[model samples]
Target: MQGVTVVDHPLVQHKLTIMRSKDTSTASFRRLLREISLLLCYEVTRNLELTSKVIQTPMQEMEAPTLEGKKLVFASVLRAGNGLLDGMLDLVPAARVAHVGLYRDHDTLEAVEYFFKAPSDLENRLVIVVDPMLATANSAVAAVEKLKSRGATNLRFVCLLAAPEGVERFTKAHPDVPVFTASIDERLNEQGYIVPGLGDAGDRMYGTK
Candidate 1:
């Protein structure tokens, strides 16, 4: 994919396999998600701009590399996104947070936004949108569109799994924003679910239907 990067790290793939199993319990699934997100977070922020800053270490004063410009913003797409959000925050505690609430309309497989909140200084920061699955790309696209409307120019999308259909639609819709995922599954089922994907991420995480 042109604008997509599939994180094929060994640990990421290993954890994803466990998460994809139907027998995995909610507690275990959530735990593995948080753990994997930490690894994914490492890859997503790999290219962040770095600037040297003077700092006093235990040994002596030295210039150390630190993230440049404004702090990062992780814009989570509602409930499922929070699974990725928790671990991302664990890695970047000082990073700001944003929430874009959206749900899939089963019949149309379209996103319907119910709530949205974010920092006012969106244009100054790099926003990384997080969601566990990019099945239809409806929610991911809508969330990014909403953020851009609020002045977020630099943005990236991160998910645990993505469908080829979803990736194509998402990239075509917002070619400027890059995508990071653990895997691009075979295809999306008729109900807009990623085939052979870990079933409904939100449901599995929360033990809901």
Candidate 2:
């Protein structure tokens, strides 16, 4: 857990419990994800560099702290990542967006990318990659690698749940990038699913499979 930070906020834990329930409806699950993501977003960006800017207040002129440098980029790992993306955008309305489309090849549980689109100025921005689950870390690793290839030096990975195996692999693969998650589950099942997890996140979020 060297480079990982678990949000563990009361609101985040409460909503995650509801999301983990099998009986939760798709609409409810999606809603909870968006809500929890806002809290996670708060924690993830907590250390963002701040610079004071002079602004005029009704009473008088004052210097207010504002985010420094270019706007941050939220690079969503398509589909499930969008669940977190929606709420993150609500919190950081000025942030830019990026999408990296990848899917697991069932046979190998490896990521296969089909599409990618990101801002032209990646090196100048901080990119946070969002994906709901890090069961195998295959997709997460691939997505981060793709972004690094495109000049994203300052990057982070955010997910709802992560398995110990996935976390170890991810950290070793990209130790420079920090990870944020709601929980690190017990372990991953044989089929590459997080044991006792909320089930397939994308499936539960979209009512598929």
> Pairing residues by index, what is the TM-score of model 2?
0.99
TM-scores, each model vs. reference: 0.99, 0.99
What lDDT tens digits, residue by residue, belong to model 2 across residues 1-209? Answer: 89999989999999999999999999999999999999999999999999999999999999999999999999999889999999999999999999999999999999999989999889999999999999999999999999999999999999999999999999999999999999999999999999889999999999999
Model 2 worst lDDT window (10 residues): 195-204
lDDT of each: 0.97, 0.96
Stretches of candidate 1 above 4 Å error? none
lDDT of 1 by residue, 1-209 (tens): 99999999999999999999999999999999999999999999999999999999999999999889999999999999999999999999999999999999999989999999999889999999999999889999999999999999999999999999999999999999999999999999889999899999999999999
Cα lDDT, model 1, residue 91: 98
* Runs off by more than 4 Å, candidate 2: none
> Quick one: how many clashes does candidate 1 have?
0
